[model samples]
Target chain A: MGTWLALVASLNGLAAGAFLLGAFGLLATRQMLGCVRFFRLQSLALVASIFLIAIGMRVPDLIAVALLDLAIKPLLIPWLLRRYVREELFRRREIDQLLNIPTSLVIGLTLTLTAYFLAGVLPPAAGAMGNINVPIGLAGLLLGAYTLAVRREAVPQLIGIFAIENGSLFAGIAIAPRLPLVAEMAFPFDMLIIALVIGILTRITHERVGTTRVGALATLREGAPK
Target chain B: MTLFVILALPLIAAIVSALPLGRKLAPSATLLAAVASVCLVGRAALTVAAGHRVVAVPDWVELDGLGALILLLVAVVGTTAALFSWGYIAREENSRHLRQYYANYNLFVFSMLAVPMLVEPALVWTAVELTTIFAIYLVAFDNTPEAVEAAWKYSILTIMGGAMALLGFIVLFHAMRFGNEPFTWAGLVKLAPKVSPEVLESAFLLILIGFGAKVGLVPLHTWLPDAHSQAPSPICALLSGVKTTVVLYVILRFVPILNASGRINVDRWAIIVGLISVGIAAFLILQVTDYKRLFAFSTVEHMGIILVAAGLGGAAAHYGAVYQILNHSLTKSFCFFAAGTTLLAVDTRQIADLRGLIRTSPIAGVALLFGGIAIAGAPPLAVFLSEFSIFRSGIAGQHYIAIGLLAIFIIVAFFGILHHLNSMVFGEPMPQATPMTPVHLPLSSVLTLILAGAPIVILGLYMPSFLHRILQTAAQGLAG
Candidate 1:
């Protein structure tokens, strides 16, 4: 490979690794603020990867996607979360994770490795411009799903969901950067609505119940212990 | 032109209904748009039934026999739900919240309508996701503690599912060579043979699990009961009847492509999941105390039956599946409408709290009783006929184990539903119940109930041959 191509590949690899690290950071962090920071970093890595791919593949639409990615994820979503954190309305400050940090990290690693194996099974997109990012993208997605499942607090769960969106976009940019303009633009707008609705719910929930922990949501179920 | 009107009318209604001057007029305005939707969708259905596909913009917007069938569903259910909402929400008399309610309600209808109209796969996914967002606020419309909680759980879980769906679509997009050719449903089916087996396998599994959660298949169905039970009754009908069908439509779109790939036993997986959902939800039905929740679990059960039919994967089974989709959509909506009416009169959704419903409100009690019978798959109802066809197809395909399991679950569900309805409709009035005095319903609510109810019986006894022929074409389209 030429020097420029090699450099681009290395840059993508670094950003992808950063994405994984951000996921791990989410599992390790106890504070709500820490979870949001990790999500922001993860989204930043995704935006960086999208930017690199846009320039490398010369896809102008992807460049637009990257710009929206920056605005929605790294900037707007964190701003929303930070506003929640500042209010300190939710009683639960710690993540109160369902799984321990170390076990969660190990599971994250296992998921990443499994994603790599899964990607290897598929025939390589022949002559694809980008190289070897699909595995990392899948890894990020699995880990995000794990976070969403394991976290007890609403904010951390929101972060987990954000991470999943980031992973999806990262994977999309790496592997299939040629979606129609409408489909490409829809994800970020969808993100904006998700963030907005979640923000409102979190506030409403905290105000009513004094905590945004979903464990307390059991009252709606068919049979609850008296 | 018809397609554009079908897609645009709900959206225009949504915006106009939200404006200050239109808040009082929201119900009428939305009702008009919904009526227009029915006419346009029926026209499109007729055109497709005549053996020519409706292709308005090639890959961007098109309708075939399958789309036409689903479009017909959105139109009928959307109109009925709006009609019911007029009576349901008006009595609440919270004018301040009515604007937001109608706005989101119309938007939800629009999203469901767009699902069948759009031909682009990614755009289809986007429309499905939009339904969740639009309806989340509606689910939490009452802003009660339980309402918010249900909305929160529903949104988070479904968005996670949406993420996986997005990944699945991205992989499919990549597999299709990044839209080098048309990536529409027809395009993908044509190209499916060339796509690698492993890629197809992975993509199909991901898509199934993702959309399965949205369909309220078991194990991922924790939110379904809660969301449906808590949402306003009219919206509950829409969610149970129309929204789940719309998402399932996305999954069915992939059947032709998966078959073409020739790598995966996609139907077997569908059948397995379908059976599990049917089996689990059947028992869960017996445990639910809320009348709305009882209806909600039934929704899950019927979805399982549809999946099982689709999984049987024969010409007969495919027809049964599509027919079941129509039957379940109409039947479930009518059931929800019944549950809503009862809840309105008795001022409670708890089954134990309701008694002598027929004594208190004959319209609601009769609606609940017959709607329950229809949904429980009794003879001479649409559900029973469709389900019988599914069994015939299963036996024809020699899917003995699946058929046996299905029969057991359907019987269990039958008792579960009737047992609850029997008590609620026939018992002596609960003395402690606040609304011991009989309550009268608005003429509009009664009319909408009849509008939804008559179809359950009429379609069961005799289907128009034209509609039957269209359903056959739709099933064939799915079977490829």
Candidate 2:
């Protein structure tokens, strides 16, 4: 490979690793702000990978997607959430998760490894430009799903979903860099709506239910549980 | 021209209804748009059913035999739900929340209509996700703690599923990118044979499991009963009736593509998931204490049957699948409307709480019982005809094991439904604790029921030859 191409590829590998690390950071974070911070950082890593892939592969549309990710994920979504959801919800509050940090990390690792195995099922032709991004991005995606499963707080669960979105786009840019820019542009707009809608929902849940501990929502269960 | 018109009507209604309008204005605007769209969709369906694909922009904006079927059902329900909402929401909710409800309702209908009209796969995914977002507000419109909680669970889980499905779509684009094909469903089927099976397999599984959560497939269906039951009854009609079918239609688009790819046992995947959903939801139906929840679980059961028929993989089976699609959407919506009326009369959702419904309000009691029987696949009903066709195809194909299990599950669900309906509709009058006083049923609500109920009864006895032709075309396209 040419030197410039090699450098981009290697830097993308670092971004992919940091991307997965951000997922792990989500699992490790205790505060709601910490979870959001990890999600922003994960999205940044995704943007980095997208940017590198855009320049290296000369796929012009991904550059736009990278900018959209940079603007939306790291900045706009959080700001929108803050504006809509009360400040108290984002206060340095610890989140109540289903599992402890250590156990969650172990499961996170297992999920990441499994994601690699899933990617390993593909022919080498599968990840033509994906290189390390495919497996690492899959790991990030799996870890994000894990984060969603374990997080009980509404905002943290929301962050977990964003993590999944970031992780998937992280893999997507490398795999389908040439997708139409219009389609790629729709992603940011879609995220804006998601943040707005979920932000409103979280606010409503907090106001009406007196808590955002949504996992305990058990009224509709069969047998009309006590 | 007509496609854009159909899409534009709901969007215009959404904006207009969201404005600070009088209470009647929002529902009126929404109902007008819905009824107008139904007329337009009827024309489109007829054209497509008569043998021409509807294409607005070749590969980008289009509809086909299968798309026409879905679009037609969504339009029909949108009209009835709009009418039903006119009475249900005005009577139950604060007048201040009325415009907001109608706005969200129109937007929800718009998103669903967009799903079948957009031929681009990624655009289709966006439309599907849009349905979830737009409907979240309506799901939580009750403003009760339980309602918000249901909306929260529904949105979070389904949005997660949508995210996962996003990855699936992205991977699918990568698979198709090199083939120089247009990324439409038709284009993908053509490209599938050349793509590596591993890539296609991963894409198929991702999309299936991702969309499956939204479709109320087993293991990801904890939210369906809660969300469907808690949403105001009109929204529940949309939720249980056509919403699940919309997402399932997206998943079914892949079955043929995977089959075209060759080497993947996609049928087994559908069958396994279908059977599990049917088996689990059948028992859940028996245990459900709430009448609305009983209908919700029945939705899951019917979805399983459709998926199984689609998986059975023959022209006849595919025909059964599409036929069930039509029957389920119409009858299930009617069931929810019935449940809504029953709620109107007795002011309780609990099956145990209702007694001597026929004496209290004959219209509601009769509608409830008829809806239950129809959805339970009683003979001479639309669901019964379609289900029997599925069994016929399965037996003809000699799939004895799957056919046997499906038959047993159907019977269990049928008895469970009848048991619940029987107790609620026809018991001795209770001591006058609350005196079983029936509220005055709304003219709009009664009229909505009548309008929606005709097809359930009529289609059972006889289907128009044109609809049969459309179903045949839809089946052929779905089964490849």
Candidate 3:
């Protein structure tokens, strides 16, 4: 029992470490592919955490959840991102981010601290698994939202959005390990479909207007100007 | 059984209608599928009215009075939209786009129906997200520059909201763990009192804002007008009429659980956001130039009113809100179909270019005039009756300030819509525009306009015993 508890704690620690690393990497990376690769790692860590929790809690059904995450998140999403990049922005690999890497990293760290502070403020619920997981998960969530706001490219924005999902999944696993297996299964499928739809929309935008910057999509308004 | 049929039939129709054989007979196939679903809805409504709830697959799918009310709305509007699509889309696109359009349209209806039917909270959120994905494709069906852009904006903004809502779901699911209850609506509501107050409060706020964004609440509604104006007219009718109501229903589903929390007054947040949306959209309506956009902003305003009604926190307010849902769905859809026919007749959506509409297309012009009046909450129309109930509930609940503010904004919106619509219907015809051949209105579209309008007039003046009973039950159910 002691060994199992230690193992669970260390596994959750590893998951939080991976999530924070990916979030900081999101701030540090200029290449769209690199950001997506970080998301893949974050999702992989989340899957590992889910497996650890399943093992610790003796709930075998979560194996399916881990497998679904592995199939959709680390494998399928990254593959789709690669294809989207090839199709939409053939020559461009780097995103011209709104904030420079060093400054954004500083802000990302501050967000992590803010997340810790915010999580500290919440009165702890009884059934939560570990103290560190919620705060770390929140850190990932905040960094992910910040990345979405700061990134200008479409693919990076998609990555940021996926990062938010990863954070929530991590928090959800730690806080509610007994969440219905069906609900857990549905999350990955929804994210997969959303990624595919975003890919299709990006492809269309690229082919028609030769740009995938969200800032460029400001033409529609109240009236057609004379 | 009936619940599953109401949910699954449209999805199956969407898939089957995507096939080559089905594409060739898309309109008839879609109409048949829609009619079949309406039959199922009628059956389910009967079940609910008999004081029996349908629980399909245990906790995953269920329908009670509130669900039944929304199901009936989706069925009626969906059938009309399908019929309107036949006449409105047939002449506008090629066979390939037509097939894709019908498929997406049906799938869109399926997702909306799934929201009100699903009992599991997570699955309900999934269905709501599915609605946006399916609808965004339909929004961009035209492949025009404006259409693509609008679809993209609609996708990103609403998905962002969906993601936040998912976060709330995660928190709520975590809270449910405290009592070892299932993560369904009934389970969560049953467990609400045991959950930590702090967690419940945060979850409620996150959810209200998250789904609130999709409901086109102010400051998150930049996508509403763009998507509405750029999409084909039939699709716009569904987006404004059925889609918004369905999302709001999802929001309302959480009301019982939030009420049970015993730690927070969630209605205040609803009232605040409701007031802002109504006030902002009402003022913004005066500045819109596109006729379709004008209708779209009116949707935003009406959504605000419904939210205010929901926020008022009384049995009567809940009743009024559900009744308003039905009224807005019928009247707004008729207005969009009328706008589509008007666009078809005149070949433009610009308000400035659509002068003397009565001279050009008398039926469509008259439809627009009356539909506009119905939407503006004029007397002896469906919206008027519902809005009156909302006001009475607000006064009774002592939400005097909110009611007063809502009254002012609603009147402003009323004149704003009436001014634009009246000019288009009654002003002199555009002198510079060339006289064109009179376009014949499709039989399906005429039926849609007449069918949608009939309920608005009839239900306003008289309510059947069964409907009144259902509304009362739904309102009571919503309150607890």
* Highest TM-score against the true fold, candidate: 2
Sorted by TM-score, highest first, which candidate order results?
Answer: 2, 1, 3
Q: List TM-scores of chain B, every candidate.
A: 0.98, 0.98, 0.97
DockQ per candidate? 0.69, 0.76, 0.61
Summing lDDT over every window of 10 consecutive residues in candidate 2 chain A, give the lowest-scoring window.
Answer: A121-130
Residue-level lDDT of model 2, residues A39-121, one tens digit each, is 88888988998888888887777777888889999999989988888888788576467888999989988998898887776
Q: Which lDDT tens digits does candidate 3 get at residues A1-226?
A: 8877887878777877887898888878876667777887888888887887777766688889999999999999888766765543634566567888888988988998898888854444233345666787778888888888788878888788888778777766766676677788888999999998888888887776678887667788865573
Q: Write the per-residue lDDT of candidate 1 for residues B174-233, one digit (tens) a residue.
A: 777723569788888888888877777777778888888898988899999989999999
Better structure of 1 and 2 per TM-score: 2
Question: Which residue pairs in candidate 1 have backbone atoms (N, alpha carbon, C) closer than 3 angstroms, thus clashing?
Answer: none
Off by over 4 Å in 1: A82-86, A89-92, A122-129, B178-180, B434-436
True contacts kept of each: 0.71, 0.76, 0.56
Clashing pairs in 3: none
Q: For model 1, what is the alpha-carbon lDDT of residue B8?
A: 86
For each candidate in turn, the TM-score is 0.97, 0.98, 0.96
Model 1: which docking level applies?
medium
Question: What does candidate 2 score on TM?
Answer: 0.98
